[model samples]
Target: MTTHPDELAGRVLSTTQHPWRFALLVMLALELVLLVCLGAARLFLPNVPLIALDLPILLLNAIFAALLLTRLGWWRAAGFRALQRPRDLILLALPVALLIVPALVVGVDVPPFGKALALLVVTLLIAFQEEAIFRGVILHGLAPLGTLHAVLGSALLFGVIHANSLLVGRDPAFVAVQVIGSILGGVGSAALRLRFGSIWPLIALHTLNDFIQFSASQGLAVEQASPVLLIAKLGISSLMALYGFFLLRGTEMRMWPVSAQSAAAP
Candidate 1:
């Protein structure tokens, strides 16, 4: 499931020449287009509500997943192929548990069935679109700049995107806390991709962590006002950020197809 050296060389060359900057500009343009489309849909198509926790989200995820497969191919895009190592799961599970437990402990009020349905829907959406844009396209495109830049760029974008949830009139401090968590989580997830060279496990972990937090909030388990909860959330998130820094600095850095090839020769 490795990327071929020839293909990798071509990608690196194309990116270094003219297309990388062009592609980045194109992506930014498309992002603007998407925003406009969503705005128009909200205004003109008032009746067409996008279900955030239903079949619509699942469908969106499916579409994004398909796009990844098409663009990157089965091997490189599958991400699951790189998730075979045991260390991957261990790294993901710790952060996920830290995020999920305290929130659940506080309690939420949603019914079990409803929670399950919502979790399935939102999890799929988060897994698909978030991972595709952040890990797949952004990180992959920025890989030529070295791993640190890729991690920082992707993590910043991810944090900004997650902050959109604050449009519902959340408190400034609360929003800041959440934004910080997203940055931390994004860095860790980006680091995971660096270590394992895939997106599937990180996608899975992201979906699970978010679902648990959302479910806890809905169920009234998470105490937003509690100092203890805030400390716990921020503490775990900070640890993740530190861990990501070490992971990036360590010698066990994951290699792309070209680097792997170079390392293989005598």
Candidate 2:
């Protein structure tokens, strides 16, 4: 019997889905290239704006997501859902709350709020663009592999991509916590896509979470290195991971099909 592409993907994931394992490596390589290119471009031009790269990157990911959906014949599932349910809102809110806890723990610096508008703009741009790329295009491309594989693949990629940004002057422990939190966020985003088959809620949640964090960290000057802040970050990250775990286990039994099990066998 000839296996369908989707079925084949599902099968590969059934045994031990190494999709994220591989995807992260490729994403890291691309990120390195992008870093070099950006540095070189800035060096030569000296006037190129960093934001110039944001929109184009987002557009490319949106295009890639569309292409993947087309390949799987799920092309129509490309945009936002018309009516986001209460549960979706609730799920999105949990992470936002996670973001706020650190602020409460260490107290945010109020001075940045004066420039909150600019901070909000930057967070919106980066968060939506990055989420669309990792959770949309990259995740959708791995969809043929099954939801579990897609989530893992996309989450790992998201984590690694952010790791590059965290390599600078930040605390290593804090960076590690944020990466774990990002992975947790990735899981929630993937679950939302699997349940709703759209990216709007994820996009919203992504933007809001970042906006809250940016506003808190920069605008409010929440103590970044305080022990209290670190605990809150890790604590919330753990909670998100737990939430993602249960959400996945619950959703998988309902949505995955029998074909997923047999697709991998030759």
Best by lDDT: 1
Model 1: which ten-residue window has the lowest total lDDT? 49-58
Best by TM-score: 1
What's the TM-score of each model vs. the native? Answer: 0.71, 0.66
Cα lDDT tens digits for candidate 2, 101-130: 666666776445447666666666665566
Model 1 lDDT per residue over 1-266, tens place: 86665675565546534424733653564355445545666787767643222344345445654654453433363243555576656766666766666666766444488668867676767677777767766666666666787688777776776554443334456567778877887787788777776677777777776676556445322224345545665787788888788777772433345343432221
Candidate 2 deviant stretches above 4 angstroms: 1-33, 45-79, 84-87, 109-114, 166-171, 219-224, 252-266
Off by over 4 Å in 1: 1-13, 16-30, 47-65, 72-82, 108-110, 166-174, 219-232, 251-255, 258-266
CA lDDT, every model vs. true structure: 0.60, 0.58
Instruction: State the displacement of the C-alpha of residue 22, model 2, in Å, after optimal TM-score superposition.
Output: 9.1
Clash tally, candidates in order: 9, 4
